[model samples]
Target: MPLNSFKSKDNNAKPNRRDSHESTTRRVGVNPTLCRYGGDCRTKGCTFTHVNPPKDGTTKTSDCKYDVNCTRLGCHFNHPNGRLIDQKMVSLPDANQQNTASSRVVSQSPHLEKRAHQRHQQLSESELIEIIDQFLSKVEEFDTNDQESNNSDNEQVLDILEQNALQELRLQKFEFQSAINHLTAEYNSILSSTTDKKYNLLQLRRIKQKLERELKHWESRLPIYARRSDIIEKLEKNQVLILKADTGSGKSTQTVQYICDAHFIDEKQIICTQPRKLAARSLAARVAEEYGCEIGEEVS
Candidate 1:
């Protein structure tokens, strides 16, 4: 019968262990197929077998197309059991087992055992102390490097803060300087304006003094101004005095001014009677011109 004849016609048929063993010939020391869940598989009807393979390599089996790397669930080729493969499907040895294996290998070889004994003697003396000192120095160097890096980062942060502070100070300084300049300009303008006002006042005082002198000179030329002291003395001695004077002799104008100057009475208190309104108006106009005042002020 052909090898292909052994293939089951029913796709869902349960696998027969006896037929599989007879057809492939049970390989001694070779493990059955590993279940997908390894030793942790709980399904009672699972098709793949889970078993530990012997470590002695005493079994012979046909190689798979993909060897240990095959991933197909229905593959019929041989693959390494979990114990002979990686730690994923099997528990790894602890530190004690590794040390026992190393010690065993060392004991099995005379050359390795002699070398290990020599190395042990060297470690009991100064060579082991030197190695410890070297490790300490390397650790200290790593710590120093980390500290220096932290210090550099702190310095950079401080520099950035200082720069920001300086910029703010500069901005404040500029604002203060601008305010001071504005106030200074205003003070200077007020001072110049006050100076101009003082100059104008001084010029007006000088002009007033000069005009007073000219006014006195023009009053000296008036005909009644010559007899001003005599008229004032006569009025002081008498309650009433009638003095006759020719027209245009300053009697209507200068007489009242002399009376007001001698008595120190307000100009509005004195009254003068005239025969014609035109003459009174003419006399008031002339008196105002001579008094250096407008018509309704000192004279009228």
Candidate 2:
């Protein structure tokens, strides 16, 4: 017996598991001794701020009233059933065995699980209909529930649906009103800016027009002299002209008319001019075509 006691004490002194039992917590997936900045859950009020993270990393992460794995001094409690959340928080399936539960939202999921989640996410209409469907099913299954039960059940479903539909309509109306308000504000801002700029531009244009009109008045009275049709032709043939005319002068237009009239007598008139048609007979065809188009008159 003495020999066995000695051997057990020697085994107990052999290190490892004893060192593990008394250690405090650290943040998930971090070593406490290596971290200089104190990697604890002081900011978030977490339970596992003192215990070493599990080696396999399958530790449950929950903010709950009852938590067994929580190493916090006060409330490291464990629920009789594993989940701290109740059945109503999830859509529980009503079956013979009542143990089936919906797990909390988690990152990891398989194809069937993801499809189920997608169905749940898009569930506003479905959840409402399901209550009525369940009532009908219950009525069919139970013979004891009578006319009063049916009436009450139907009314309850009706009230629920009416409230839901109204809520949805109100949400849609609010969204529309917000959109209209935003668009109206944007339009009014744009209109005011354009109005201010337009007035400034109009003032500039009026100033320019007034200066141009005054310059024209001064120009009209000055008489240096323009040649007649024959004289202009003679000047062109001799390659010379002497001219001064009113700013409102047909002087520029008359030079071209002189050239055109001279053509009637000159014959073989090479109506040579600028990039513009500088003589009348030269412009006649294009003018006639435009006139025809304007009045819907056909031209061959």
Write the residue-wise lDDT of candidate 2 on 86-193 in tens digits: 433334443233322212221113454446434433444334235334433443443244334534544345665455544443343343344334433543344345
Candidate 1 lDDT over 1-300, as tens digits, reads 533346444577445433455444333223345433433445544445444222343333444433444333234445555212223223433324533322322233445544644454334323433443453354356447645764565434566545554444334334334433443354334434545654534333323322332234232333455455567788778878887864434577567766664554643377666786555655565454444344456432
Q: Candidate 2: lDDT of 263?
A: 45
What's the residue-level lDDT of 221 in candidate 2? Answer: 17
Model 1 residue 176 CA deviation (Å) reads 67
Compare the candidates by lDDT and give the number of the best one.
Answer: 1
The residue pairs that clash in candidate 1, if any, are none
How many residue pairs clash in all the candidates, one count each? Answer: 0, 4
User: Residue 155 of candidate 2: its Cα lDDT?
Assistant: 36
Error of 2 at 47 (Å): 94
**How far off is residue 262 in model 1, in Å?**
2.5
